[model samples]
Target: MTASSYPVLPDERLAAGVARLAVRHQGRYSVETVQRLIADSYEQLAANAHVRTHLVVLAERFAAERLDALAHIESPTGGERPRVLFVCSHNAGRSQMAAALLAHRAGDDVIVSSAGTHPSGAVDPHVVQALTEAGVALDEVYPKPLTDEIVQAADIVITMGCGDACPVVPGHRYLDWPVPDPDGAPIAVVRSIRDALDARITALLDTLPGA
Candidate 1:
């Protein structure tokens, strides 16, 4: 709940994330405030990791995005909320989780799409189980490959381990979540990854400029 309660991180890692946030948001937020904000953000996503790699990076990103939203930042989309595309190696796992989570949480506030660089035959059974457990139905959704049209239209492109195969449109807001491939991971691991996505997605929706 407070910065002092932030999940423990290595001193250098914590300070780096804090300083990055403070400097990037220098004009709008003070260094002291950004430090607290980054710590709080780290706390928000800390519980979900089965292993705590890259928590600081994700936290800094989530914190900075929220701070931008608090300032009512505008984007290339102008008055409209963003349309986000989630891409991964296959549409079966991480991308599917992200798409479902964002849709469930954001509703009509944000448009959501997802695709894979190399399409699989169907959505992974475990991914479906995870979504069903969360009460978000997208059973009809299947593995689909990325398309230029969707990529061009998206206001934000979020790649979850898609690597070089992900499309790059010059004007879009591109972000790589660096989420691991969830293909063979256990249900518990999948859920933990889902929680991370929830943190990032919520922060993203919060940052969307309204129509």
Candidate 2:
């Protein structure tokens, strides 16, 4: 079917089921394009609570039916490693902390990235300071959008404060840790967040195969 005639799914389920339809029709579109279309259509069905409630199923289908084939599109020619994405409301606090701490502790065992639901362009100064104090040296960290490639590449997606804005892709492990925001907070509080994130990172490392 042409893009103009692309049927909008009724809700998440229908949106999710599009791949099955495509499979049945042996559609001309590539799986990547079809998955992108499905995601866009589902996001438009923003009215129903069932769509939100059924997100896990939708994500699962999206991953299995669509994402799995395209999951490592960003990796190197020889294939790299499993990635982890950390997301927060601003990408300036919790996500940055978690990502930095994980990278520091895990020592490149996993590829780690962080993003925002609504990015603020720069990492928070306090977050940088806290991480520096904790010896993480976050000189390269910057706020970025939560993209499809990032989500697909990540084996685990951790959301600290993005709430409902974080994308749910199927077949990936997702966690929402209700950590407090450290923007404009005092150094002590920032340090506390740093410590907390380090703890979480340690736990995450333990779950990894070679940790």
Can you tell me which runs of candidate 2 are displaced by over 4 Å? 1-71, 74-80
Every candidate's CA RMSD: 15.7, 10.8
TM-score of 1: 0.61
Per-residue lDDT tens digits for candidate 2, residues 1-211, read: 5755654444546544656645743544464556555655345323222225554344334334333324355333454556788999877789888988888887767777777777664677888888887778664555555667667767789988776788898888998887889998998999998898788887878787765
Worst 10 residues of 1 by lDDT: 68-77
Q: What's model 2's lDDT at 13?
A: 60
Q: Give one digit per residue, the lDDT tens place, for model 1 in 58-120.
A: 667656555654554333335666778899987889998999998888878886788788766
Instruction: Please give the range of 10 consecutive residues that has the lowest summed lDDT in model 2.
Output: 42-51
| TM-score for each candidate, following the candidate numbering | 0.61, 0.63
**Deviation of model 1 at 168, angstroms:** 0.9
